[model samples]
Target: MTRKQLDTDIVIAGGGLAGATLALALTRAIPALRITVVEAFPLTPDASADTYQPSYDARSTALAWGSRLMFEELDLWGALARHATPIRHIHVSDRGRFGATRLAASDHDQDALGYVVDNRWLGLCLMSALVACPQVTWRAPAQVRGVTNNVRGVAVQVASGEHVTELQAQCVVIADGGRSGLREQLGFRVDSSSYGQHALIANVSTSCDHGFTAYERFTDAGPMALLPHGSGDRAGHDSALVWTLTDDALERILAVTDEERCQQLQQRFGWRLGRFTRIGQCHHYPLTLTTVNEVVRPGIALIGNAAHTLHPVAGQGFNLALRGIMALVEQLQQAQVRGEHLGSLQILRHYQENHRRDCQSTVRFSDSLIQIFGLDIPAMKLARDAGLVGLDLLPGAKRWFARSAMGLGGRRPRFGAVTQEVMDD
Candidate 1:
């Protein structure tokens, strides 16, 4: 097991959530298999040098129940719990007309609606687990310039500071992100569309306690979500906002001083929390839907953002990635036990078939929701309002919808995902 850059049974090309999870799962399932993860971004020792940090990062995620189970299996939930906030209630509403729907934790007999955690914190937990997993190897600041598929396996040509080296593996998984450097190189097509909107995310403090209730208000500009932060919130600072709006509107809001922006938030958002007294650094991201042509190839497979990227309206992209990673591990484990070729085209084909339904469904769901709620047409508005009214009439319709938002409604993974955890560990 010695090669300058080669020799590995499984090579994962990205260290993001999906990649890390897949490596861990495979290692646990198949003790004999060796896994290596190549990442471009490494969690630095210095807090300031860290590109992703909990407090300052403008990005956070609404992890689904299924994803929560994945964290538990990887021994990350305990650490994640420290920085997460439970979503006790989700309030969905439209401005002007009183069309709103509320889903409370009580309806589901759960403590909260869902969990929201900072991406940086979650990533850190994952990295920590990776370090302890004996079957896994971590490589970072490495760029994959080429990939060559051979008779035995695939060869990954990496450019680590001008010195090129080849890493061999039976299969290569792409977890680089939505914009993967190796996606096109693997001969797959990707499609994307801008929503003509930008999302401005930041952490804010409020006068009143939100009590774990998250607000998904459909403002005249666009949809804005205010999710609660987990435990360490020290009472006063408890919420984070993901405000999406037209580019022009977003720019106008960003131009003003933080003082004015806080006021605007208060004006449009009302005093639900009295007033947003202070906001952390404001960051912006373009809202768009990116879909890849396929999830699997002969010697390469794509997971997470590399496979399909959707509008953040639902926040299921990352969760979906976790599910895919789980499934891939299951398939590889069975293949290994059966003495089957893990990197064979037939194997990936079957894996793709199992995940295709969930991938397409999630992408379509997010795209459809964005178009549906974003419409201001009179008839569409009437229809949407009527839909909400219908949902309210049904006792648990709102709760069911909330579960779907958690990414727990899709096809069950073969390894089996119960309620949400990996079935039978």
Candidate 2:
């Protein structure tokens, strides 16, 4: 296949958060690029914001400060901020322990440490932006069955219902998710280890207000977090919960009555928010640490959970993926300027190299937290308690910890608009 015979410049194999965000970022940075996104589910670009109803059990993602900046560059933050709740303070403590530490946004001279937005609203915003871009095409209710690399580009086999079609693109991005079969189909080596834990997620109302504070409590069972949710009068009263529990514990928690479940939660979580008065529908997800041996190959790349899935102990999964998206976009923009094939190994290698350290550091950070806190040794417990206490007295160490959590500890990618001078070339 020749360049002229290619159907699109890129064929994205999943249209979830990672795929949609990549499409928007690429089109925004390189306006003339033609892209097609293949998603298995239906997308509603025409979703009405005015008629939108917030779900009490809606899933949410914590967008780090750096992620917010990237969205601002992409011009999606304005719409996102409407439904986002600011996490002005974070209270970290060990249940039944003597030490604790708190981080305040005001201390760091920032508006908020982070923002939590429902996944529904975030998807709507991305879909709206994608609908307005003429260079991008959506192939929903469709799946990429296979990808074949040729000397010139890549051939993508897509299936929708009874019809199957093969399209050609210079590059194919696999963002289907952590459980992506395509990655395995293409023979990518993956290393996966289960944490022997499940995260029980739900939205709960408290007897006392959250005061815009997020809580991270380490318990003998596992790590649990409560992120503030809702707005106006509902703001401080509601929170999204992620409680990590072992398989046996998870089974018991799910079998219990709602009242009993709430009581169990109160015991593990203590009375930071007084009491858990109401609980929404509960969902459970097994925790795992999965990493790909190579995130890039000739004519192919993986992003989002497809690239790496971390333990939710730190909520770094999506934020890390967002950073990877921007880095890939920056490299693709540079490749276009140089008139190189989008899937050339040279270009893909640069993307991987530039993003390697960040990926490793983040994965290590998240995994280490679980390893450290999951320990029940008496000496380990005493040391961790002292460390937490010392973290407050040591300003530099505390700032570093806070920055790491905010996703601002490393080389930040620049996703600014490509100059007209470069585009004209």
Candidate 3:
């Protein structure tokens, strides 16, 4: 019945990619802020150990330019860049259609559109940086029993090892994931809708080099994305596959052998990447768009998948989450400077309001792409084809689309001089 009590300025639930990244950013922004990150999965001493690490489990993520800037501010990009493959160009096309679009980095006056890094490598880099910070405490392989919002702050019950500890913090940020148990325990309601499709992800090889070109090919079933990656996999595969398919089609695809799967994929994807030679183990995730109606409570806030999860058609899910974190940091910096309560309703509400527009737009953009491009109607097909052609033909339109895809459009949180000054101090 007796438990130890610990107090801190902030408690971040989930030390996955989002949580770890946010923790690093927070320390960089406010070096004096006390923080503790609780992760359900243990940090394996060896990344290659035959064990589970949630952040490292996924295939890969395309880091948008905006995300790159944020990492640069946190001084984590240099390490990340060593393992990242720059996406110099983006090729988008409609299967069996004549219309296509090519977005080159030069067109947008950039050296590269984005970078793709394996999830495992990214996790290692973030965790390594996190452990070096003396201001943060990391509790791994821990279980959160419950959460209670109190008049002054938030109280969390965490069971690590043999003892239960009550962690009291002025603020709690949930970045656990889409199916966050803590979010549910906190009585937050999520509006969720399935896409009736599943994404089959794996590391695959091509006959020829990818040339650091990312491909977005739309087929009858759904969108198939191929992102380039540096050497990592056992077979020396240089690309990550995200092939979306309908429920019926996914069943067939998942049932086939690896060779058969490769053959089928080549048939649908065409000769853009030559032949599909080698493939790693395939993983399937049912696609769904879920968002919490309210991302902020008096003492708690939601970031990453805990706040909203979107379709990967546009590869905006993680990028959107990073943007929201940047916005939240902006608000928190002001609060800290003004000596205001970080867990106050006013501070939480400000973050929610500042992030709402970007979250809604990114989700809508991804969802619309799924609906509009997946249409089988002849008229809809023609319109979609025209849209692609128009985007390629018009310089202004192409530039705008490229910017959005690069995560450069709209209002972005300042992560330059201000961030540097914080690091310097």
Q: Pick the candidate with the highest TM-score.
A: 2
Show where candidate 3 strays beyond 4 Å: 1-6, 46-58, 231-237, 415-425
Specify the poorest-scoring 10-residue window by lDDT in model 2. Answer: 43-52
Specify the poorest-scoring 10-residue window by lDDT in model 1: 416-425
Tens digit of lDDT per residue, candidate 3, span 173-263? 9989989998998789999999988998988888988877889999987899999866422223368889998889989988889899999
For each candidate in turn, the TM-score is 0.90, 0.97, 0.92
Mind giving the per-residue lDDT tens digits that candidate 1 earns over 348-378? 8778888888888888878887788888899
RMSD of 1: 3.9
In what order do the candidates fall by TM-score, top score first?
2, 3, 1
lDDT score at residue 306, model 2, on the 0-100 scale: 96
Task: Return the number of clashes found in candidate 3.
Answer: 0
Residue 389, candidate 3: C-alpha displacement in angstroms: 0.3
Give lDDT: candidate 2, residue 107.
Answer: 94
- Cα lDDT, model 2, residue 275: 88
Pairwise TM-score winner, candidates 1 and 2: 2
Model 2, position 378: C-alpha lDDT score: 95
Task: Score candidate 2 by lDDT.
Answer: 0.90
The runs of at least 3 residues in candidate 1 whose Cα sits more than 4 Å from the true structure, single-residue gaps closed, are 1-6, 42-58, 230-236, 414-425
